[model samples]
Target chain A: MPFRHLLLSLACFIVFSCKNETTPAPSKATSQRPDPHSLADPFNDKMLELQLKLKVDFDKKILSGSASWSFDRKEKTNEIIFDTDNLTNRKSDPWERRNPNHLYARTP
Target chain B: MTLGKEETPTTFTLEPRDSILGSALRIKLSPNTNYLTIHYSTLPEAAALGWMDASMTAGKKRPFLFTQGQAILSRTWFPCVDSPSSRFTYAAEIETPDGMMALMSAKNPQQVSPDGMYKFEMDKPVPPYLVALAVGDISFQPIGKRTGIYAEPSMLKKAAWEFADMEKMVETAEGLYGPYDWGRYDVLVLPTGFPFGGMENPILTFATPTVITGDRSLVSLVAHELAHSWSGNLVTNATWDDFWMNEGFTVYFERRIMEALYGAEYVEMLAQLEFWELEDEVRAFGEKNPDTHLKGNLKGRNPDDGVGDIAYQKGASFLLMLERLTDRNKWDEFLKNWFQANKFTSKTTEDFLAYLKTDYLEKHGLTANVDEWVYGPGIPANCPRPNSTKLAIAEKAATNIVNAIPATKEWTPHEWVHFVRNLPKKTTVETLKKLDSQFNLTNSGNAEIRCAWYDTAIRRGYVKEILPQVEEFLVGIGRRRFLMPVYTALKETGHVEDARRIFTKAKPGYHAVSYGSIEQLLK
Candidate 1:
């Protein structure tokens, strides 16, 4: 499969006719989350794998299970963070939000 | 059933985080602790789980339990790093009540287990948002070799009949892109109040029964969800910011599938309607609203807030423009290979741009206003204008309606929607009555056309006569797409009391998601 000559030329023509506002070929860090939505820094110790087992309790409308999360440490660290609760869960579940950084003081 | 903050497990802690709805669990890293585990149970009011009693189901004798994890709700159902970026393989053994069946977004069982314990497995890794579960007194009948339908016994035959083209849709999509990587594509026709139109849960697509209109006019939604098998379930957008990566690609692919099955003119009607929807939404969002951008800013806001017609329509329009830029043959090749190359991985908008440049643009000696399309606010000026010769005929007929002319007869629901959309503002009560008598739109069985006519009726201040029909439609269906505008229209037209009364009646049937959206609107 290939691009036809006439169409390819037409595409290039449109590009040159434009204001040429295309930014320089995006750098390696082209993918960005300057203001990241996630609180957990997956990079510090990347989660390599996970296994979850849950039982649905229809009467009580609860699912009870344990999730086994496996990850690798990028560098030796005394502690790690896992983002686990949602603040909007005020109505559904009983939980509270403290901070985005360390939920509690990191220990060595 | 909730995990207390103070009672943190020795291995990790489930604590709250600011700037969002859900909480994150922090687990301490240990050399010996290669796998850390947390035992958690979902609350009855868990966001992901929708527990419907026998009264709420089609069978009216069996309970149904389903999970919706999109945007960020999986954590409420099960303990995991509930993020769209974290892809993981999972297996589950759900213990259902006797005479029930359980299904997951995985390899599923065709029959109900004797003891009610059903097991499921998914070897391919998927984000938490794609995780889904449905349990009920459901039965399945194969529609094609690798396609089928699953519904409660009452809806089984009807659902199978409606989605009879499931096998052909898969073959058409595969012919355009690549083979259907997921083993089988099945659909679970959920009850009326199942919230969204469809959730692209890997092997089985959780769909609203609203799509079972008997006429198959709305099966395009099924095509849209099926296209997700490649765009979303296979090559995924790494973050919610690049949501258009998932939706935009899927919408574009969905249309092509529809075009394959029902010709370009049929698909063009939808594209034109999407353009109209996008225009209205952009204006509603205040053309410059950051929410109107393809790459959305959901910072400190629920990611779901970024979704609207903007993601689906705008994103699709941008891709449509690109396809026209280099022609279909080359564009199909680009997308087909792109899916093949990036299958089963999470990618960002930047990664897509890089791939688009080197793989297609540079290779084909082509360039597009990529930044203007993805990064800019509102619909890009260059978004392709959708036109259909067949739709033009309908549009002409619709245009004549304002001048005492009735809309064309024997029209598809799509054509009715187009006519309803083009109805002149301040159309007199006389005109509404005329259209109603001529079309019987209020009595129409089709939900889409019914809602479309209802919108006009409400705005024309002629809703009082059709009050029963209006209330029934409102209480019967819980699709937020249909619910929001009608409720808003009622609320704005000094009918707050009526809207509240109807919503109150419909509250129990509404999914948590639908309830949340309607509550915010009627608030």
Candidate 2:
């Protein structure tokens, strides 16, 4: 009884909607103005590669190493990145730029 | 429900969008993907190595690599959002040695690759705290049909043999709550250096070596972490501000499980010990910050740091009071319903209280402002105080135990030996003397009380008389059952030798209750 409204609506929608026929089309004015800023989700596609690794040795009482990571961001956008204050830039070879502030930043 | 949708990179334009809240650029998301990734690491510090593990007395820094060891440090082991609301499924593939086994937050471990790599996939959405990885020379022993795996070469057989009861424990939990969505469970014992004793990473758990007392009697830590699968891993705190959502509930559930498995008296004794632990911390000298106590400011108090007595004590106490406020029979049902509605999602103090009010107190024929009691701190001054009469009786018994020393008007070597064997049920001199004649009490005496007696005993020639017990006392004080008294005695005596022994034997234990004293003593 407490969820009567939700249950009633769901039941009616399921029973009536399943009877399938010609669907009503949106009006011309309403259909023409689509929102442009709506963006697609980022996690789709196997484009970027991600890997998390660990190295620990108890015999030597050693727990040390860096998390090896390699990924290619096809493009850039404002994403809530995972960054750490402890990261050190070891090397970029001959020439490489660094964006240590962003966890989701692209390699340069 | 379908959560967030992904989009193609080309779906949005190249231009950046402006926002009032600092930088605002919308991502062109994709529809196919339903996951997120986090990375962590650490930089060099001069005193790091010494602080990570200290052999010296005073100035020592030991080097520690939280994620660097597990290779998750690149993303900082903490959840990226700084909130528990951000829960996501993760799959990790570590390129480690073929000999070394790497444990991840995986429900299932896929086959080891021909290239000598392993890929582990975790199906449940887990918080960062619950996302753990351990790389070590380890092996596994499976427990029956349901409980999938337990990895620890040294203690694998012990862990398997000990936790054989876990399948039933989980079933009991499910019968009380609901079916545990995560199919199977296991525990991975990490090396001694692992900071925390146990990380309840859903199906897989990372435990500390220090906790595995070869006899495996102290397997309750396993129960506690397993309880978190429902209390924390299933439904998490939305923000660190609501740490109780995870810890408090877990403590409550852990106590219940312990009570069910190990008898109510043992659990009650454990609860009493937990209460005393909180009492000691609150009473620590110079710990004047009311905010630090339980009431003042909750902001900036890191989730990990706040796991001190405040979370364990205040949090568990809060849930106990909630149970008192509602019907006992209905409480379990309410929790199950709450989990059914909110599992695998982040929640706040207010959110939990609201549900409690609606589904519990109100429905159970009770009228109380539950929020005021919980969100407020230091306990209601007017709340029912513990029975002082009972406390007085116990105090009297304890005092008698303390005063009952039988050797030489002061502690002597022979007397010390007897005292350890005939340790007082309560601290009293008579109790200490009763065992002095026949048994080697030196080996059996509680560390805390002996330490308490150290100063007086030293003044009364007790230290010189029973120097060996003082040494043995320091080493034997690791048990939680005797830590409080031993700590008090140590503080009182200030004996350098005794202090050194504390350091030598200060191995962190499995229970959160055990670690409090060792870490505090180290500090």
Best candidate (score: TM-score)? 1
Model 1, A1-108: lDDT tens per residue? Answer: 111111122233223223222322221111353425555554455565555566666787666655556666667554565544321122122332221121112111
| Superposed Cα deviation of residue B210, candidate 2 (Å) | 4.9
lDDT score at residue A16, model 1, on the 0-100 scale = 28
Error of model 1, residue A25, in angstroms: 40
DockQ of 2: 0.06
Residues B5-116 of candidate 1 have per-residue lDDT tens digits of: 4332343344322425444555454443444545455556667788887777888888788889888677666655555677778777677778888999999999989988
lDDT agreement with native, every candidate: 0.76, 0.47
| Candidate 2 residue-wise lDDT, A15-62, digit = tens | 222221233222111212111111122122112323344333332433
Candidate 2: regions farther than 4 A off = A1-81, A90-108, B1-79, B108-116, B148-151, B209-217, B282-296, B381-398, B402-492, B496-523
**Model 1 misplaced stretches (Cα beyond 4 Å):** A1-35, A44-49, A76-80, A86-108, B1-11, B17-21, B402-408
Q: Which lDDT tens digits does candidate 2 get at residues B36-153? A: 3222222232111112232211112221222321111213332232224545566665555455455666654523334546677766666545556554445666675657444435
> DockQ (Cα-based) per candidate?
0.14, 0.06
At residue B82, candidate 2 shows an lDDT of: 20
